[model samples]
Target: MTLQTLANAALILILVGWIGIRQLTWRPILVGRMWRLPIVFAAIGLFALSGSHGASSVTAVDAALLSLELVVSLGVGAAMGALATIRPLSSGDGAPDAPRFESRTGWVGLALWFVFIGVRVGIDVWAGALGSHLAASTGVIFVMVAANRVARTAVIGLRVSRLATVAPVPAGAR
Candidate 1:
């Protein structure tokens, strides 16, 4: 199969990961573990990167684009992640680290997720149609998944940290 096809297939998989993520309800997503969606995204991101890099020799412009993608993706992802509805819940043990949480952005969150996905798909389609190597570049797909995960996880972590600080002590523990 052609490299472009391989890369596009990989790009399509990223959308699958996002769909799975959207199905989830925000409940202590990162509290005890990395969770399935992000893990899937990471694995998928890495796999796509391998396809992008192995497909051909990367150029300086490709590297620059990758860096730019990273910056934009991360910035956008961070904003989206921060926008996620994260709030602490009372865990059974009442442990500081064991934060119970929930997330919901309603229509806005879904719209944002779709917007990012649409843009990524559009880029992949446009580049692949022209046989531009950018379509096969690892950076584009990698940033799409990695940066979003970073932002969401960071937001969850930050919110959890804030909650831990002000949380009232559990009855017996206090």
Candidate 2:
């Protein structure tokens, strides 16, 4: 439909593909692949810029607020990613067959990006500048995050169950 809606849909698809890639490969597709993430981010940025309502209404205060939101979201996401990355390593767990998905930290990065979209949508809505464009963009962000996390959780649960089923029983059996 609208450019914003299209952009949002593209972002959601990217996130889904990102998660699947991580789960199946246990690594980020971007790492030596280089140009991919940058290309995707650039495309999304261009889409957002093109559909944005313009900077006429973005006062210094609004800019500051958006900046703060971005910083906080990024910080939180980075912290989470770092924590997730370090957990298995620090636990002295034997090395995995392949490095875990933490190689690129894409999940946290995507979360931060969604947070930015949320703040932008909130600001636009508050300013009465929202239309179908903003609504669609925001809706896609929310839906994608929710759906992706749910899928991840389900996958994790299934993996755990499968592992338990295959693990050998201890000696001294009943």
- Cα lDDT of model 2 by residue, 30-89, tens digit: 223433443455455556545556533455554554455445444543443442331121
Task: List lDDT for all candidates, in order.
Answer: 0.60, 0.42
Indicate the residue-level lDDT of 1 in model 2. 50
Which residue window of length 10 is worst by lDDT in model 2? Answer: 84-93
Q: Which digits, one per residue and each the tens of the lDDT, describe model 1 over residues 1-174?
A: 667567667766766565546635555545446445566666776676666543466655556545655666666566666777765454456555554565655456666666666666666555555555754455557546667667766776777667657774454542
Alpha carbon deviation, residue 88, candidate 2 (Å) = 11
In model 1, which runs have C-alpha deviations exceeding 4 angstroms?
Answer: 1-24, 35-40, 51-56, 95-97, 137-143, 168-174
Q: Give the TM-score comparing model 2 with the true structure, all chains together.
A: 0.39
Clashes of each: 0, 0
Q: Between which residue pairs do clashes occur in model 2?
A: none
Error of 2 at 40 (Å): 3.9
TM-score for each predicted model, relative to the true structure: 0.67, 0.39
